[model samples]
Target: MCVEKTPWELVIDFHGHTCPDIALGYRVAQLAQREMGIRPAPDSECLVKAYTQSCALDAVQVLNKATIGRRALIIEETQHHIYQFHFTGTQEIHQFTVSSDVLDHLKALQHPDLSPRERQNKVLEGVQYVLTLEESAFCQYDKIPGELRKL
Candidate 1:
């Protein structure tokens, strides 16, 4: 007998601040349960929060320095993540996610070959891919757009 595994989705957080992390993290947990049937232990919150805080600080520091130095913003876009985290002097961190769906929607918007409905479907698929990325907690920055996607 062969068992059929469900296809998984990816997660990407886009243009995020720190405070949103908690909520998004919780949501991700819930989504995982519903979609993947993976029940993360109660202590999972601690791990999620830790990751959220760290990423937020890094993003913030980079943005701040770029602002003062008049350097080009250091944009880190990977296929895996859309949102990031950062901190400032005497400021608490925040968290957020862009949802993979959003990027897929953007990609569909950029593509001319598909019908409206097809493009919409593509967007949905892309968003799902991003969600998987988030759940794994591994982010890859600086992913260039695929060559075929270049306009």
Candidate 2:
């Protein structure tokens, strides 16, 4: 029998590679969707403000269908794993940040001693480790205080 991939599995394929950041983004997006009581963008009906230009951005685009081309996804260069999603036609906004422990693991993957091949293997392992985490293990959602501006 043919097995169906979950939405996040499809996100992994669309992103062309797996990493801890992307996995964390996937979880964050899911949390935002659930909290905002919104579904994936059927068109260009939502906007995403991602505060980092990392692999996680690709997952956000894929999972939320919020692409820069559609003026629905905005990238801001920052040092944090923060993302805010706003559904068009409503004041609802959802904000999330990856847990510090997960971020520490991602930083550790950048250790200079590892060879290129070793780094590659370590990244794969990190991705697997992140994928195995329960929802609360990788991210924290913050109360949406106000509108998030694009930068």
Candidate 3:
């Protein structure tokens, strides 16, 4: 039977695998959408600035429609899980900074000694950990004033 995949499933498919990074990105994208409340207007667009490069970004590109090719997704090498969403024509920017607790936990999962199968299992565990994390514990939410237009 051909079944329709859920949005999360589509993100996983677009990302090519399920991992903590993608899970983190998916959560950030979903939260950003909820926090923003409304969709963009005809003249306004939602732009994303990501501080660090990770597989998580694939989720943002999929769920937020902020693709790098379109110049709507900006990525930096700051190496942090911080994301800023700017709604053009608005006065505020929404920033989400992933917490240290979550970061540390994900880091602790990495090990070079495990077998391939073991590594795969750990990766799956990490994905589950991130997907089920409490929303409030996932990241710190902040509303900062900034220039909204990307240009």
Candidate 4:
């Protein structure tokens, strides 16, 4: 008999490691899909614009099927954790920002005194913490202006 893996398990495999950032991204991708009422892209049909480069980006690529190589993902350098998703067929854009409280929690997880292995373990713990959170707890949505919206 075969056992089915949870979506989080698939996300961890695709992301190459487990961390809070990846978990956060997984949640964000899920929320985006729910809000837009869209399924994962079959190919390069969806575009994701991320405001910062982080472990979260990997999860977004995996969960949304939006990849940089396929021109379905865009990374913009910024000091914020904001993401925008655009679907080709509907010309819809969904924008989201990580909540400041969640950001503070993530930042507090980092420590300078821990060994490398200890740090890794702590990050994994952080991932678990994030996984336990409610969707509305970690992020907030931003309204997109009609003029700036694009498919």
Best by lDDT: 3
Provide the global lDDT of candidate 2 against the true structure. Answer: 0.77
Greater-TM-score candidate between 1 and 3:
3
Pick the winner on lDDT between candidates 1 and 2: 2
Q: Candidate 4 regions off by >4 Å?
A: 1-4, 39-44, 143-151
Give the total clashing residue pairs for model 3: 0
lDDT of each: 0.33, 0.77, 0.89, 0.79
Which residue pairs does candidate 4 place in steric collision? 91-151
* Preferred candidate (TM-score higher): 1 or 4: 4
- The list of candidate 3 runs beyond 4 A from truth reads none
Candidate 1's displacement at residue 85, Å, is: 3.6
lDDT, candidate 3, 1-151, per-residue tens: 9999998999988988889999999999999999987866877778999999999899999998888888889887799999999878887899999988999998899999999999999898888988899978889999999844443
Tens digit per residue, CA lDDT, model 4, 19-107: 88888898888888778674546532667888889888888887788888877888888968899987765545789898889889888
lDDT of 4: 0.79
TM-score of each: 0.26, 0.79, 0.93, 0.82
Model 1, 62-129: lDDT tens per residue?
32222213322234344343332222121222233444553354444456788978766665554444
Query: Distance (Å) between predicted and true CA of 21, model 3?
Result: 0.2
Instruction: Select the stronger candidate by lDDT from 1 and 3.
Output: 3
